[model samples]
Target: MRHRAGIVTDEMLTIPKWRFAVIGMLEALGVVTGMYSAAMLPGPAIPILNQTFLLWQLGFSALLLGRRYSWNKIAGCLFVAAGVVTAIASGSESGQMLSGVGLLWPIMMVVSSAFQAGATIIKESVFIDAVAHLKGKLLDIFVVNSFGSAFQAFFVLLFLPVLSNLKGIPFHELPSYIKSGAGCFFNVGASSGCDGSPLLPLLYIVNNIAFNISILNLVKISSAVVSSLAVVLSVPTTIYILSLPLPFLPEGVTLSSYFLFGSVILVLGLILYNVPQHNNIKHNSDSDFM
Candidate 1:
């Protein structure tokens, strides 16, 4: 991860604007991947079973830093859980099962999100420490992206057999609705069936560099608090769009009261989770961890 961040930092010297593009792409890829997973899963559960991991990530991050859990952070985790519930509640029991054993998509998203959130925390420490040591943001970015890619590459290669199955394959026919839906999961990479997305990994690299810049710029031009909230506006917009009648999303999929309730909770949780706390942070925070 450190290596990846370092490389990205170097690229900034040649092209600083790439960061914004990268951020937008990364955000789009994650959201698109997630929506695809929801369409593919049984009962079309959004947030699925993997929601547990995010909660765990929140807890793990807290423990990793030896920080006591504040009510806001705890509530934030709960809201993340609630968001998943809302997604599930909005789904149907009679949803379609995925054609192949492609469980890796959701798993990848969860794992990546965990790494991402943790890295965000750790990078801050690195950047601040770099200030005292005269380190640069470009170096820090490269280090994060490089290592993140390197570590995740193992999984990509390990899942080679699965990817081999789809190297030149085509997806089975999709209903016209899904094919045309704005939230459709078409054009999945043919790298592997289980989760062989060279595209995803590459996108991950590009995305880290991008959003990291967006956040930095956003904070630079304004403040961390403002940038953080601005980034979240996409959530409810996604939710609303997903709930609406659309040509691409399956017609049978319906959002329930429970799902809406859960979604609201999730929104709340996320809002709380990101709230900066004076008590939760301590001295000696570093870039190796967040």
Candidate 2:
């Protein structure tokens, strides 16, 4: 059926050579997100860190991208900030400040958001050039995501070995570098079910696919700042859901009805703002911002 539909098939299909540059770095991000979600994790701080990231993107867009700020954009940012504040205020697990390993979660979110913003800029700057020289979007996805996968894989590999070795190695038995490295690596690497589990690689692949695709389309349809805003709008939904108190709720986190409702309203507002309009600011600019 696939062949009849003009679809090609190959069991030995492989990602192109150039498609790996970004993967390793992104993998490291997944690792960080995982670590912060662990038991007794400081959950409120994640939203705060995300808020900081948006502010950074806004500043960079103003300085480097020369993004002309408008009243609507300003309002949008404010709304997002408000939402973050709300989430953070209500995201408390024990109604106390984030502490211990949980204290680092928000910081990780800042780093993650920074990398995401940078990825957006790089992807945009190179996308058109690649299209004119190489293949279009299809090849673009292949090359770009392959490189991303590779980058993420590199970090995963480097840390995975040491982490895997940590099983029998007593904490006092390890050197300072190994101990510190493991702590930091786990901060990002400790995802849903990581451990020495065989499914860790597969989980990372799934996470990358979900994250990268959401971001790739976002950049294609909007500016980095706008894409960052969209992320702000979208991510809370997923996180909130995962944090919910549904049947069989996980040990680490759970969401309330309030968060879920807030996410819905937030997404609706973003869609209204993002929908293509006749008077789009990008149209007024260099037409490239569109």
Candidate 3:
């Protein structure tokens, strides 16, 4: 259906195939390395250090796209970084400190995040380039997403051996392990001890699909940096949602005092970042008057 609709064809793309392949490879590398490093890192450090991706996105947008950000926008990004770190570090009950884990994993996590940020920027560039090259026609978001995800899946298969080892599953047993996991996921076979089964994982899969689609659509209409910032803003909301008592979860943890303070800072940062550039607005108004 997508092919018939002209969404999957190369004719819609502005960039060459090799360049798109490179972007796909970047996406795959980012996901694989991010998962590997995250598996090694402690729980708290994951969120705290992941805030680096925002800065990386901002930097890449400037360096690669020749986009200049105002000082307030940069500061707003910092506020967001600090707010998330404060809320996550102080609120989590277990392993609240990052002192135990060594520096290697944390460094790897940041690098992996940079890879993802680079992919995001490059994808945004594809959209921007398409406008000029496609006779004002916009590229379909799925063309980017489907290809990127297909590449990622291919890379995952290639990296399965290493990932299985990291996950403590024997390389040979990986297939069986996944089979059993699938059985549990579907609530079939003799897979015991899978209480939640299909519901939880289905919800997770659905939610992830929706989130990625939404974020990719956001990138289609806005700059990559803006989409990244929008994701950063979700940290507080996720925290709040997890804090609430839900049917599926055990007793939900109450929001800490740090959450309130950090949320305020996060909101302030978003506001600061979104403040319009005076020069751009004045130029637009002048054009309108003319």
210-268, model 2: which lDDT tens digit per residue? Answer: 88776776665556666677677766766666665664454547566656655655655
Candidate scoring better on TM-score of 1 and 2: 2
State the displacement of the C-alpha of residue 248, model 2, in Å, after optimal TM-score superposition. Answer: 3.5
Ranking by lDDT: 3, 2, 1
CA lDDT, every prediction?
0.48, 0.55, 0.78
Q: Compose the digit string of candidate 1's lDDT tens values, residues 136-193.
A: 4423444434443454454444443444344442334333334443222233432234
All candidates' TM-scores? 0.47, 0.58, 0.88
Candidate 1: Cα lDDT at 288: 19
Judging by lDDT, tell me the better candidate of 1 and 2. 2
Q: Considering summed lDDT, which 10 consecutive residues are worst modelled in model 1?
A: 281-290
- What RMSD, rounded to one decimal, does every model reach? 10.5, 7.9, 4.0
Q: Which candidate is the best by lDDT?
A: 3
C-alpha displacement of 44 in model 3, angstroms?
2.1
**Candidate 2 positional error at 17, Å:** 9.5
Give lDDT: candidate 3, residue 99: 60
